[model samples]
Target: MNGLSLWDHLSVIRDPCQQWKIELKLADILFLTIAAVIGGAEGWEDIEDFGHDHLDWLRQHGDFENGVPVHDTIARVMGMLSATKLQKSFASWMQACYDVTEGEVIAVDGKTLRCSYDKGKRKGAIHMVSAFNAANQVVLGQVKTSEKSNEITVIPELLELLSIRGCLVTIDAMGCQRAIAKKVLDKGADYLLAVKGNQPSLEAAFNDYFRLDMFQQEDANGYSIQEVGHGRKETRLSLVMEDLSILGDLEYEWPALKTLGIVGSIREERSQPVKELDITVRYYISSAQLSPKEMLEATRSHWSIESQLHWRLDVGMREDDCRIRREQAGENMAAIRHMAFNALNSDTSFKAGIKRKQKRASRNTEYLSQVLSGLGLS
Candidate 1:
């Protein structure tokens, strides 16, 4: 597989084009798309422009026998390609590039690709469920569902494809299902699932345990952290109880339920009045037995999927602004963004943010080649 080069790793996706009608190769198109996207190309035209401008650089890795295809042809072919095939190939490529460490936190979350919705076609927006390796700051894999509610069903499916053994998988309350918990256990990984109103009895149990009058300070381990940043001062307190007797028979329902945790956050913005300050508490259930400090870190680490993956895709890459809603195009393009993000984020030599790194890559072919080299290209 050419040491898992972008072209070789993605070649496993069967080409959707008819053999007799084929001009541009599938690998060539995908390689160009991913590289161009990494180099700050936003849409089909931008990708085509990038290809024409860097044909020589691209040819070093892919066989550009038919030259760069037109933007319309690129869009047509990309829209016809199978998103599932691309996702699988993408996961395989990630596995080749990065190794998941034992006990690492794998945050699972969903994001809506807003502009992908086609009101004319009566198709809703595409919601992507992604597994992000928090410590490594890279996307492990992703699956797209037609509706946000479908995340519960597809998350387990996405988890099925990744090598998550010995990792701690964290999800918000939407994924706090017993089946999902069991699935995580089955995958040889532990789960740290949030608890909310959806699980009435479980939420009540956690509430009762921490109730002001009934709470026993000695029964739980506690940790606290404070931060001052972005014109705000915040403090977080994490409390975890390892004793399952608190749940009585309710504990029997959750698979490998070893600990229960809660995080209380107090925030004060510089511009906000005292009354406008924020204070909130969130609950979680976990299969891993962790100390109060470890629980606090793990719970906080879960948000990296938002700040790192989702936020970067939206703000850094302008993914939500892209209006590519053609058949399978939205989903495939999302995968390409993830691929580009992984390459950019994994390259530590630049010592700059993703946006800056991308800008540099777009202007400097040498820096761009360094970025591609991280993906084992050339």
Candidate 2:
């Protein structure tokens, strides 16, 4: 078996380990951990177990000459690593694997790592804001909020880390600030932000401009999507306005405010002879001069981050169940989990869910190597 090597840039992150006590190279240990996580190792003990069980296969990737390190040693090593540095390195690696294309929609959203809190240390759970490629289903980058900060501050920092040129950056109401809009524009990207109570004036502007009567016109600028499945029918309508003659003073506050939009949804459930209907409406703001159809697709695409990235992390990976709270251990582990996600998704030969892929990685050495090759770690 041949030892794997990391890309030069990823290998450049400085090791925080004590030189005299170092038995394994930092890159080797980091990659080893990523491989274990992909194979369903949830904690240090699981990782150590994985290493021992697959030491011979692991040797193809690194010098496990002394065998797998103890669980505490693995924890200690990760504890000493800088979360910020690890994120930067991970972001670079993601860019290397996935290329952002022109007009690609990249959704930015935040999720709280629920089980990462330490009561004895009086620490709260960590909130990670991630930038995800909607079309490609790849994580472009992520940033963690500091002890006393919120997503508003971390979001822009995360945006600055990515190759966002010629992309559409979408965010929820929490990121609808003028500063965030300008930041996206400055990065050579367009903004598609949801308008809600957080932006009181903007939401009011959208509400004021879009009265129910306007939707009655035959030439109303809007697009609609319909889905029917299992005794239910769902329809989504997106309405876009190019002339912000209705925006009043609110128009100037947002940068490149070319259009204001609204989306309405109606769902019908069939049980009796008659059907019941449920309807909802939402507002949005965009910097790009897009048509209603374009607006609809971009808006719909934004949810991919939740469905593709966050859902998989919680459901398949059991991210919420993990309790690896110690210094930078939790943060580092989360980043590695993401790496595992990227690696697993890269391989199409394994035609199954993430859980099945992990099970295969555990039992099939050759398949594990193929998965690691996705990160260029094998």
lDDT of 1 at 334: 95
Residues 75-194, candidate 1, lDDT per residue (tens digit)?
A: 999999999988988888777767787899999999999998899999999899999999989899999999988998999899988888899999999999999999999999999999
Instruction: TM-score each candidate.
Output: 0.95, 0.95
Query: CA lDDT of 172 in candidate 2?
Result: 93
What TM value does model 1 have?
A: 0.95
Window of ten residues with lowest summed lDDT in model 2 = 1-10
Off by over 4 Å in 1: 1-3, 212-220, 270-277
User: Mind giving the per-residue lDDT tens digits that candidate 2 earns over 248-334?
Assistant: 888887889998888888888765444445878889889998888898899889999998999998988999999887888888888
Candidate 1 lDDT score at position 97? 69
lDDT, candidates in the order shown: 0.88, 0.84
